[model samples]
Target chain A: MPEYASILFSEVLKILMLLVPVLVSVAMIVWLDRRVWAFVQKRRGPNVVGPFGLLQSLADALKYIFKEIIIPASSNKVIFILAPIITMTLALISWAVIPFSEDFVLADINVGILYLFAVSSLGVYGIIMGGWASNSKYPFLGAIRSAAQMVSYEVSIGIIIINVLLCVGSLNLSDIVKAQENVWYIIPLFPMFVIFFISALAETNRPPFDLPEAEAELVAGYQTEYSGMMYAMFWLGEYANILLMCALGSILFLGGWLSPINIFPFNVIPSPIWLILKILLLFILFALVKAIVPRYRYDQLMRLGWKVFLPLSLTWVVLTAGYLMYFDLLPGN
Target chain B: MIAHAVVFYIFSFIAIVSAIMVTTSRNTVHSVFFLILDFISISCLFIMIGAEFLGMIMLIVYVGAVAVLFLFVVMMLNVAQQKNEWFVASDSSSHIPIGLLVSLVIFSELLIVVGGWKYKAELQDSININLNLNLTNTQSLGNVIYTDYVHLFQLSGMVLLVAMIGAIVLTFRKRSGLKTQSYLRQISRERNEGVELIDVETKKGVKIDA
Candidate 1:
């Protein structure tokens, strides 16, 4: 191969290494989501597919593949098809910056967090496109609702991340993680972590903030008009985003790849395993919140994101900066 | 390198095409999507030029928030169905010459600036940014924004704050005969007020209103 072709081949291989696991894990995560929801409701969830229903997600994907794809006659066909592709693509690509372990990232860019933020922000287009292209009232309403909800919560998310940034004084995700070697941010920035988790829920359009797709009101929101593999793509993208948020939570607060007790036995484990475990822990909390918490009304959700979270996170940013400066511990000073 | 030039041309082509399509697209939603595409392409160019922070920020701020809001309004209203009126003949078409003249002047001015820049390349450093090539793009930009140009940065922030407040004040409505919940009053209500201990009579019924 030529030099450029060889470089391209290796890059593609690297991307596959990162993405394949993420997509596979999305399957298990969905199964886990169902199991948790079932456990909360005292029911057996998908035990028929495999032991503990491990292969259920695979079966679902197969079913989606075999099913007929129906395009609504009134819909805009180009955008209708483009939306889900964009969703899944963006969701998967954001993983390029996420460090699984020290020196394990695909793209160790300097502006890693900003790159993630940028990709996640573009995520709204998928939902909005699917909604508006449907040419239906329900999807349109859902799209409009999510656009407002996302933009509102993104402000607070940015502020909360700034608190973490101030401590580390770097935008690199790994640097942020390394800064937590002494103590995880969860101890000191507990409130900001709580707000970030909640905002993550809202950002992913999960429960307690899933006004965009409220079944009672909007009939599955933006996903209503989608069917077959299109619907499955949305489901995959959503779970992937949820997992990304979980990873982010672990990296920012729970100390990515850092064991709780740094001893001989604990230190023996590889770094990636610890990162996965932390992500799983955060993901379980997400599933539990989904199972237990009732969805919020739209107005209440807006009030929480704007009125409460905005002011609180902003104040926390100032406080963290002040505390860091007062001790003459500001990074790079 | 050849690769750099190729990538630059690709992104610039996409940006130019999308910029043109933003006005030409019949559907308002499509126009907004085109605008997003234009932003994305330009940001790609920024990133290719090694300004990763600016590129990402452009994506987040312009393509993400501003364009999403544009799509929101275009979708929510019936504006998506509105036909494109570009180049359409109107009753009074007097502004065409003035528009052409203004654009011509601007184009020539751009030409002059570019042509003169080849001879006087040093003019680019008039701002004295003191950019340290050792620092990463984010760090260098931060150093400049937070230290030397701090007051200007803060003033711009103040402008944005004032604009936000102005928007809110204009949109804020005080209406009479509307029921709104006062959360403090609702939360502070006594249990005695909420519940009545009186027993109800069998058929006569208690006057609950009283």
Candidate 2:
């Protein structure tokens, strides 16, 4: 193969390796989220599809394929169609920098964390576009709500990540995970971790911060106008985003692929499995919250993000930096 | 080198077209969306040139934040409804000439900067943007911003703080008749205050008022 063709072939293969599992796991995660929620609510989940309801997502995917796509007459035709595609694409692309294990990643850029942050921030555009294109009162309101909610929480998330970055002294995702070999950032940065987890929940618009799609109020929120595959795209994008946040949380706090104890038998398991388990742990929590918590009023959600998390995270950043400086424990670049 | 030029031109093309659309779009929302596209493409150009930190910051601050605010305001104000009238006749028509003059001044200033750079490409090293080839983009930026330009950076932060405070002061108001939730009061209230038992005689109900 020519140099460029070889590069292209390898890159395409890597993308497939990463994305195929991601798309498949999205299906699995949907099933897992439903099962967890059902367990929390004391109800049997979708056991009718396949053994242990494993093929439920496949059935759902087929249903979406067969269903009719309805475009509103007054809707912005181009953007309405583009919205879900953009959402799903952006969600998948953010995985490019997410270090699954030590050297296993699509693109191991130096500023990987920032790239993730940047991509996640752009996630709001899909919702905004979908809502705006729908040309309906409820969708517009939902989009506006989503924009404010995301923007407000992002500040705190950025600050909280700074606390981790300070310790790691590098922006590379692999370096961040490596720094936690001795002890996870969660031990020292417990408060920031909790705040980060909550912010992650809000960032992904999971309940109780899921006011954008509160169902009772906005009638499916931004998804109101979407039908068939378009609606399924939004659902897939959302779950992927949720999974991304879980991966991020695990990477930042729980030690990305590190075993619980650095001993024999415990360390025998592969790193990727550890990452998957940590992600599953976070996903279960996400689903449980969905089942257990009541939806927040829009005002309370804003108050929590801005009034509470922002100041708390900002102060924690200062405090952590101060502590590091005082102890002369600042990692050399 | 050929691939680099190709990618550069591609991103630059997108940035320029989106920049034009931002100004020419009839719908205010479309203008905002184009502005976001412009930001993204410009940031892509930045990243392609290895200024990854700057590129990501641009995306986060502008595409993610500023454009969203623009979209929110445009959507809420229903600016598209009056787009034709704004083009034809507007109460703020007098300000248009002044706006054009200010824009011309800024544009000329940018032109001068670019022209100077074109003549003196090596003049960059004398200034603060001394890039160390060994260090990563984020590290180099941190080194410069925190070491040599630390005071200036701190001052800029202070300026931002003051501006934020000033904006809050401008918007903050005390409304006499406005009803607002006092979370502290709500939480601290005694059970007796919230619930009361009153004796009722015959068919008459207890007075809930007072």
Candidate 3:
């Protein structure tokens, strides 16, 4: 093949490789959660679907594609339709910046962390618009709750990230991962790790912090009026965000692609494989928490965020900065 | 480079148009939403400027908090169209002339400044912005405040503290409906006394309970 053609072919192959894994992995996460929930509740979940419900997500996607979409008479038709699209699109776009391993990122921007934050922040608008456009009280309340939840959790998240940045001394995701060759920052910044994990749970609006979709109270929250493909998009976007958060947690705290064992025998798994294992483990941990923990009341949730997590993360930032300064690692120290 | 330029222009165009619509729109709620769109696009503009920190902060602070607050207040106000007419009508008549004049003045000033100066783009580019540029626009603005601008920062903190105290003093008032708890009152309460068991016996062996 000619050089240009070869380059183009390689690029296409790279895209295919990245995209296939992400899609399959996301589907697997959904399946795993279902299976885990079934085991926890002492019941079989979707065993009838292809080989212990492995194909359940594929079936779900097909169902969504063929389903009838109903636009409410009272809704602002434009915004109502656009909301889920925006939500799903923003969620997918953030994945472009997330590095799976050393050479796996799509965009590989210098400021990957900042880019991710920016994209995730925009994700809130989808919920806000969905609720507002619905012209329904339940969805509106859910949207407002989501907005507040995101804002409160996002602050602590930022502070925790500051702690990480202090350790890594670089904004690039790859550099941060590489900095963990000797040791992961989690050893020193355990408090920040916990804080970041909790904040991620809240930021993604997962169970115990999912006031936006508190079915008992808000009638499915922001997606109360949504059905068919639009609803599915929101659902996928949410799970994608959950996966993203888990991936981020692994990368930041657990050492991105580093094998746990330093010995020769355990070095069988490649770096990317190690990364996948860590992310999967983290995802299971998240799902376990969701399965076990009861939902927090709105006031209690806000209090935890603002009073507990914020202060802890801020203190972590200060401590990390002090340590870095003492060791002559901080910028301009 | 061309791709980035195109993207910048596209977002800039949307931002400008949305901002114009925000001011022009009769529906206050819709206008508030347009303002949000404008903020998001401006954050994109910040990204184009290579100010990633500022862009992220703008999204987090402006889009995530301020815009939400605006939406909340706008939704709660429940002002009808008739009430809106007063503000909207007055705004339109007064705004057009003032806006035009202001834009004209700004454009003319920009033209004069650029025209009067001999362009030294290279010299300006060579200047280390990381050293000279004030990072106030960054999310790490707090860091710079404590380190470089410590004295000014301390003064600002003191001012804010005083303001907070003054606000508290101003707002402090005794009201019947207001609920306040004293730590002494709280601590003094015995848990055993807070709960009690009561028993009552009624007529015969019919076992009527009270």
Error of 3 at B116 (Å): 8.3
Provide the TM-score of chain B versus the true chain B for each model in turn. Answer: 0.82, 0.84, 0.62
True-contact fraction per candidate equals 0.96, 0.88, 0.54
Give the per-residue lDDT of model 3 (tens digit) for A209-269: 9999999999899999999999999988888888888888888899888878678965776
- Span of ten consecutive residues with least summed lDDT in model 1 chain B: B79-88
DockQ of 3: 0.41
Clash pairs, model 2 backbone: none
Error of 1 at A36 (Å): 0.5
Which candidate ranks first by DockQ, i.e. highest?
1
lDDT of 1 at B125: 72
Q: What are the per-residue Cα lDDT tens digits for candidate 2 across B1-210?
A: 888899899999999999999888888888888899899999998999778999999999998888888888888875655755566665659779999999999999999998998898667465576456788978878888999999999999999999999999999999899777889999999999898877889888676774
Evaluated at residue A228, the lDDT of candidate 1 is: 97
- Greater TM-score among 1 and 3 belongs to 1
- Over A1-333, each residue of candidate 2 has an lDDT whose tens digit, in order, gives 399899999999999999999999999999999899898889999889889999999999999999999999999998999999999999999999988888898899999999999999999999999999999988888888988999999999999999999899999999999999999999999999999999999999999999888799899889999999999999999999999999999999999999989999989999999999999999998998899999888888989998999899989989999999999999973
Q: Best candidate, lDDT-wise?
A: 2
Ranking by lDDT: 2, 1, 3
TM-score between candidate 2 chain A and the true chain A: 0.99
What DockQ, on C-alphas, does every prediction get?
0.87, 0.86, 0.41
Model 1 ranges with Cα > 4 A deviation: B80-122, B125-131
State which docking tier applies to candidate 2: high
Between prediction 2 and prediction 3, the one with superior DockQ is 2
